[model samples]
Target chain A: EAGVAQSPRYKIIEKRQSVAFWCNPISGHATLYWYQQILGQGPKLLIQFQNNGVVDDSQLPKDRFSAERLKGVDSTLKIQPAKLEDSAVYLCASRRTSGSSYNEQFFGPGTRLTVL
Target chain B: GQQVMQIPQYQHVQEGEDFTTYCNSSTTLSNIQWYKQRPGGHPVFLIQLVKSGEVKKQKRLTFQFGEAKKNSSLHITATQTTDVGTYFCAGARGWGKLQFGAGTQVVVTP
Candidate 1:
């Protein structure tokens, strides 16, 4: 089976510039998530989407960051006026909705964003 | 809001030695999941513990959940070079959302 796919494995942008990251979840998966992993730290949940509807986004900075999963299969995370503190790897993950026993999340390669 | 914390931010072990990492959550969790991320790689699921005081093993790796369901531990025996990576513990209260710990970075030396 194919895994979650993401584009532009690496990205670099100047401060105050805008950047966007794309993610395509595993086929048939109904839940998608976006996380930010800073250096030497674990991935922080940014937003979650259950079939195109947001489940949680309390930690997201609405002033600068936004994400959407229009059709429930793919997602996009955007950051405007990027700050130097925003330099981190953005990871996308997906999970199936059927089984309740094991909630294993499959993660994508991630997009490494470097804001200069 | 819930928070998860990991101890020994970094661990350096001999190739043949054994070591353990710990995870604790401010709130009781319905389940806890562990994942491993190699250097420069994404996190991969390792195991999950749902039942309180449950213990599971995968080869030389042992996972244990506290009786209170608020903490977890990952013990690796006879560490090998392949074990070099960061181990993260994620705690979920309900479902679909996970609060991740800072993670313990492990380095094995020959």
Candidate 2:
């Protein structure tokens, strides 16, 4: 089976500019997630999607961040008017919804976003 | 707000030495999951423990969930260079959302 895939392995943008990260989950997986991993810190959940509907996004910055998972197979996370502090890795992960292996998540290589 | 903390923020040991990292939570947890992330790599799931006082092992790695369900530990025996990375313990207060510890970074020197 193929793993979760992410695009544009690396990105660089200036402050106040807009940036978007994309994620393609493993086939047959029903749950997808977006996380932000700052240097020296563990990945923090930014949003979670079960099928097409959002499950949790309490930590998401509504004013500057938005995400969507149209068709429920792929997802995109956008950060507009970015800030210097947003210069961290954006990780995408997916997991099975049924059967015995439900909670183990498979992660993508992640997109390294450097906000100048 | 809930928090998960990990200790021995960092550890450096020679090959063949044993290493252990602990994770603690302020409140009872429904489950705990472990992940290992190599430098410049994304986190990969190692294992998950849901029952209290459960002990599971994978090769040289041992994982234990405390009886209180608020603490956990990961112990690596006779560490190898392949063990270099950050080990994170994430606790779930409910379902879906996970609170991850800061992680314990391990450096193995030969």
Candidate 3:
């Protein structure tokens, strides 16, 4: 079986420009998550989707960051007018369970973004 | 909330030596998980602990969840070069969200 798939291994964009990252979780995984990992720091969860509905996204910066998991299989994260602080690896992960009772997450290779 | 704290921000161990990392949370977690992230790579899940005072092992690695469910530890016996990477502990509560620790960077010297 294939693992999680992410598009565009790496990306470089100028500040204030827009960019998008895509992710496809492992087959049969009902819970999906998006996190941002800055250099020297642990990943911070940005949003989470259970099927096609959002389970959590309180940490997401609505002013500039937005994500959608349409049809419950794949998701996309967009950052418009990207800031220098937005330069980090965007990781996609999925788990077998939809509740907080579990914590086994399978992560993708991640999309590394560099804002110039 | 800065829920998780990992001790020994960085650790350097000689080959065949033992190593350990500690993780503490501000509140009792529903569960705790451990992950290993190599340099320039994303995190990979290693193990998850749910029950209080739980202990699990995988080969030379051992993991323990505190009785209070607010702390955990990962111990590697006779470390090898393959053990090099950053080790993280994540705490989860009533939601699916995960709060990750700063992580312990382990460097195994040959």
Question: What RMSD does each model have against the real structure?
Answer: 0.9, 0.8, 1.8
DockQ computed for model 3 against the true two-chain complex using alpha carbons? 0.86
Give candidate 2 misplaced runs (Cα > 4 Å): none
Output the number of the lDDT-best candidate: 1
Residues A1-116, model 2: lDDT tens digits: 99999998999999999999999999999899999999999889999999999999999999999999999999999999899999999999998888786878899999999998
lDDT of 2 by residue, B24-92 (tens): 999999989999999989999999999999999999999999999999999999999999999999998
In DockQ, how does model 1 score against the reference complex?
Answer: 0.93
Better of 1 and 2 by DockQ: 1
Cα deviation of A16, candidate 2, in Å: 0.4
Candidate 2 chain B TM? 0.98
Candidate 3 Cα deviation (angstroms), residue A36? 0.2
Where is the poorest 10-residue window by lDDT in model 1 chain B? Answer: B92-101
lDDT of 3 by residue, A16-111 (tens): 999999999999888999999998889999999999899999899999999999999999999998999999999999987745534588899999
Task: Name the 10 consecutive residues with the lowest summed lDDT in model 2 chain B.
Answer: B92-101
Chain A (alone) TM-scores for all candidate structures: 0.97, 0.98, 0.94
TM-score of each: 0.98, 0.98, 0.96
RMSD, model 1, all Cα superposed? 0.9
Best candidate (score: DockQ) = 1
Better of 2 and 3 by DockQ: 3
Please tell me how candidate 3 rates in CAPRI terms. Answer: high
